[model samples]
Target: MADPFTSALVRHVLGRLASEAIEEYGLLRGLKNDLSALENTFKLIQGVLHDAEMKQTKDKRVEEWLKTLKSASLEVENVLDEAKTVAMIKSLAGEMGNKYKRRAFFSYHMNPLMVRFRIAHKVKNMRKKLEVIDANRSRFQLTSNTTSEDSAGIASEISNRETSSLMPKICGRDEEKEKIVDEICNQEIGIGHDGDDVRVYAKWGMGGTGKTTLAQYVYNHEKVKTHFELEFWVYVSAVFDIRRIIKSICGLVDKQLDKMSTDYLLKQLKNKLKGKKYFIVMDDVWIENEHMEKWGELCKALSCGENGSTVGAPLWL
Candidate 1:
């Protein structure tokens, strides 16, 4: 079976280790040694994460080791999450009285002590697991990927299907980039318009035509950069959820609105973009609506950027 824990899973673990292991505060001093050791061990595996991913296609033992590493990383992340929760509670419980704040001691002090002690034990156990896996790396004969060009030439597209936040460096799209730049600079798009007059521009093409990559390129271009004050890049998969999309956009704008009704979210979004010129890219959107009404509403919500903001989203069918 294809590995359930993909690069995203490993990326999360590596990122957490990078943040937590180096952090010298909030974490109890007693736990620092184990955390440091844990962080170094994870760094060793991080170097091989991508190589292991590719080799597993031809090796069963490597795939099993990847699964084992996934479990170890998950346990480490869980331990850190518990530590963070306790730390947050302690911070929230800033000051406390003696008799009246009985539970406060547990919240601010004892709970954290227990949390650290428990994590120390878990980290030691996980260290043993990792050491065993690292040793087996040689036994399984797994090696690092040293070449960019594989025998198959290379897949036409390398972007992940689920999501891509930062714009990645693509191989060759200079011609397409220039064409898009000309299109945007020519004033052919609705640059300064209200919701009533907005129209969708479709980049028509065939499958595997590099449509998404082209859009990503344009979204980060300098001309596009100078044109809008605020920018948001959101990935919309097969299932369409307006509520989720609104939340995602709000998050990009550095605003977090949780458990909100669709109407409230729309109102908050309207306020958020009331007078700001913004750019938004809703990438890989596939909706299964019987009619155009749902999409029309979605478009309307996007157009709620009242200050002449431009929405450049490439639709893929």
Candidate 2:
């Protein structure tokens, strides 16, 4: 799959595509409504593209959907760029000769209508493609929109924390991440029974030993994600509720569990996770088998009892 065009670039260009220049241009009169519709549709897809692009590696349909969106957006960019260039020339038509006037007239009054019609047709087809992708989102197990920036500030905070807690790259840990990655990649990671989940793995040291950072390094490693399709990070802290842990996993995959019975929830969770590789990092697990009973049950459900197995990784406390 092609490396996804960064969301930042799309957001930046789309912002200009929906600019006031397009809205106010007198020559774009017949084109305004279609341009506006295209802009709205683009906006609608922007939030979901993240999710789609994330799954593109796993699903070809998502890959195609993103490609289509990118192609349409690029065409819009080109059209808008042309319109801006024409508008600039038209503004100076008085200084230029009749040749320039004719050019400006064609650009403003005639060319825009054709541009508008073409874009509208493309956008209408793109909308149909989007509808198909939307209808099949559940087939990919997308429980919620993973790519939406629900809170820009919070996202920045999390990004900063994950990258280095707002610090410079002075305390690099490439080797540490590699070590963890090697350990994880060396084994077969899958959902399975207790015997399969019995690997003794733990990161032990004194307080503030950078265990969390080291664990996160492994968790976010590209190889680690390749080994596991479903990834979850839950900060266990002092409160060790198994239900809470299970809920966090469900939230990652966007599974609804409200008012459901325990057996039902487990069954649904198992069905949702069946045949897929998943990763769960129980941060601050405060080592105790007392927490194991519910954890064991979760393990069983995730393993689906029959077709499951597990690969072990460092469990930080």
Candidate 3:
């Protein structure tokens, strides 16, 4: 008598095999139907060719009709070849289905004995990786949590932060300024709603539409400057350097040149933006959806005021 577990495994494998066979059979039938259709189309063409001679053709219509019939014949041959391929695939899938069933049955009976061996092997490798990761993480955390022992180092870092805000000078953005200002101030132009909704202004005309300049103008304007509690400007050009972006934002907000690791920068950004109303400027964005996601991550870090709610007001150029 078969063991109960083995019997149950066999039953499950047979059920799956049956299901796969039915699917393959359906596919085979569909392919066979397609082949029949191709055959019928070929027959129809032959009938048409037979009747074409009855019509007296004075011009080159006979030659054209012969050429069309030849083309049709070639098409029918191609259709038959495709149908044959489909049929072969269906047959192969059936054989594979049977093989899978047999393999499953064998594995079900044998796998119990091997499970312990596999687990031991896997656990050995996993433990090694975990140990390495934990060691690295411990070192990183220690470094990150270090106390500032030197006052001069802290002061120098602070001074460096103060001078890093060398914003690119605004140039040739008169038309863009008019458009963006109008969009922001004019309610009819649809910029602000209850001062909560982030009015996204996209300037997607072409390259050199003064997108960056217009963004800078908006960033520095007295109205925008005073309205928001915190402002963050990140240059996310075609090359997506996440570390650089976070560093730039940190420098803008805290005014420092402290070298922050990628992980720490992200954490610091999130902490800094926890409960502040901030406007983040992402300049020179690429024409790809992935760039959008990177921007979204930075936005996620910014504190949007209450309930971490911040509206996405985008001005794209």
User: For this target, which candidate reaches the highest lDDT against the unseen true structure?
Assistant: 1
Better of 2 and 3 by lDDT: 2
Which runs of model 1 end up more than 4 angstroms from their true locations? Answer: 1-4, 20-25, 96-101, 104-112, 145-217, 220-317
Q: In candidate 1, what are the lDDT values of residues 1-317, reduced to their tens digit?
A: 35435444544454455443335336545666666666566555555566687888898888888888887778877876766666656665665445434575566445556656676687778778877777777766555442333211111011234455467788876887888766654445663333353434446443356667777787878987887778777765434546667767777332344456667777777777766777777776542332145456666656655444666656644
Question: Against the hidden reference, what TM-scores do the models get?
Answer: 0.47, 0.40, 0.36
In model 1, how large is the Cα lDDT of residue 186?
47
Give per-residue CA lDDT, model 3, range 155-210, as digits (tens).
Answer: 22222212222347766657867666545543333333333334344555343444
Clashing pairs in 3: 161-255, 161-256, 201-314, 203-316
Worst 10 residues of 1 by lDDT: 150-159
lDDT of 3 at 308: 21
Most accurate candidate by TM-score = 1
Give per-residue CA lDDT, model 2, range 1-317, as digits (tens).
24545343345344454444455444455655555555555544555555676788888977766666566567666656666665565567757777876664577444545555655565456556545544555455543333355322122212322222122222677776677667666554333336644322367643346666676766767787787677667655323455555666676332455566677777766787777766556555544334566667766676642222232333433
lDDT (C-alpha, whole model) for all candidates: 0.60, 0.54, 0.43
Off by over 4 Å in 2: 1-173, 188-201, 252-258, 305-317
- RMSD, each candidate, Å? 14.4, 20.3, 26.8
